[model samples]
Target: MSPRTEQQYEEIREEKKKLIMDTALQLFANEGYHNTSIDQIARTAGISKGLIYNYFTSKEQLLQSLIFSGFDEFAQFFDPNRDGVIEKEELHYLLREMFKLLKEKMSVWKLYFGIMLQPQVMKMVEKEVYQYALPYLKLLVDYFKKEGKENPYLEARFLSAVGDGIGMHYITDPDNFPLEECVEKLIALYQ
Candidate 1:
């Protein structure tokens, strides 16, 4: 095979990996992460379980991949370079964007919610800050610091709790949940 053929093959492999991730997240969200097995993911993706092993060594690794991919996508949207003096509109946009993504990305976020309660995933999350949601908390803290706000870590933690509340409601009823109204109420809490 030519070099171009090899590159095409690699691209196909990456695409397959992404499909597997999407299927895994969907199943995990709908079925609950604890109930989702590697075999189930493989079946949902229409691939053999053995083929999944070619992409991910284990189910945990697959879950981690979904988490990291989401992190990377949103990091840019939040503007890490901002001075942290977010205006009300920025806050609204943030709230809206978060709710929207969290809705569309329900499976991934659902897996994340469960992962936090799992001992092994929690440890892995702390140890690999670059690869998980810990960076978001850290980013919030640092942003607050740049703005001369007090106790950024505490503020970040508090916001995380608030987010969880809002997220839980949405995840529980994605079909008819009034996320926009909920977000308005959520932002009003800060007012």
Candidate 2:
């Protein structure tokens, strides 16, 4: 074959990076981050350990990328810039979509929940998460403000805490969790 064009090279690079990311995410989700090593990730990905290093400097960086990637996907789903004011139906749609994503990505959510409970891991990821999360939180605050709720900021915080608590419950007891009903009740109570 003639030398590959720049586009072909980029395509190959992206494919390899995605393979590495998917393999690492599955491993991290199934096994705790501290338990999973670069060698394990590389072996699981069917790549050499050194190749993994070429993509990610360390396992911690790999984990951060996985977390950030999930958030990026979430941002795409929500698309925070597309509206004038948030309506109750719109909020409900958002919550339902979120629940769908959570169920679909249960393993990743489990890995995320586990990491957040560990102080050291939390320290490493807290800033990045807050940065990613701020826009969504602000969206909620804006919704409440538009609804004429007093202390919209505090209400937004309360709603966020409730959502987190509900998520933890769902993550721990997914089979038995009445997610739709719970979400409906939350909407009923808040809206």
Q: What is the TM-score of each candidate against the true structure?
A: 0.80, 0.91
Error of 1 at 16 (Å): 1.1
Off by over 4 Å in 2: none
Highest lDDT: which candidate?
2
Residue 6 CA displacement from its true place in model 2, Å? 2.0
lDDT of 1 by residue, 1-191 (tens): 47578779999998999899889878876786669888888878898999988998888788777777766776777755557456545656777798888877777677777766778777766565444456567666765666577887887788878888889878777788888888888878655
lDDT of 1 at 184: 81
- Candidate 1 TM-score to native: 0.80
lDDT of each: 0.76, 0.86
**Candidate 1 Cα deviation (angstroms), residue 1:** 4.4
Candidate 2 per-residue lDDT, tens place, 1-191, comes to 65999899899889999999998888887787888888898899898999988788878888888888888887888887777468888988888788889889887788788888989988999998898778888898999999898899998899888988888899889889998899888878765
Worst 10 residues of 2 by lDDT: 77-86
Off by over 4 Å in 1: 1-4, 82-85, 129-153, 175-177
Model 2, residue 79: what's the lDDT?
A: 81
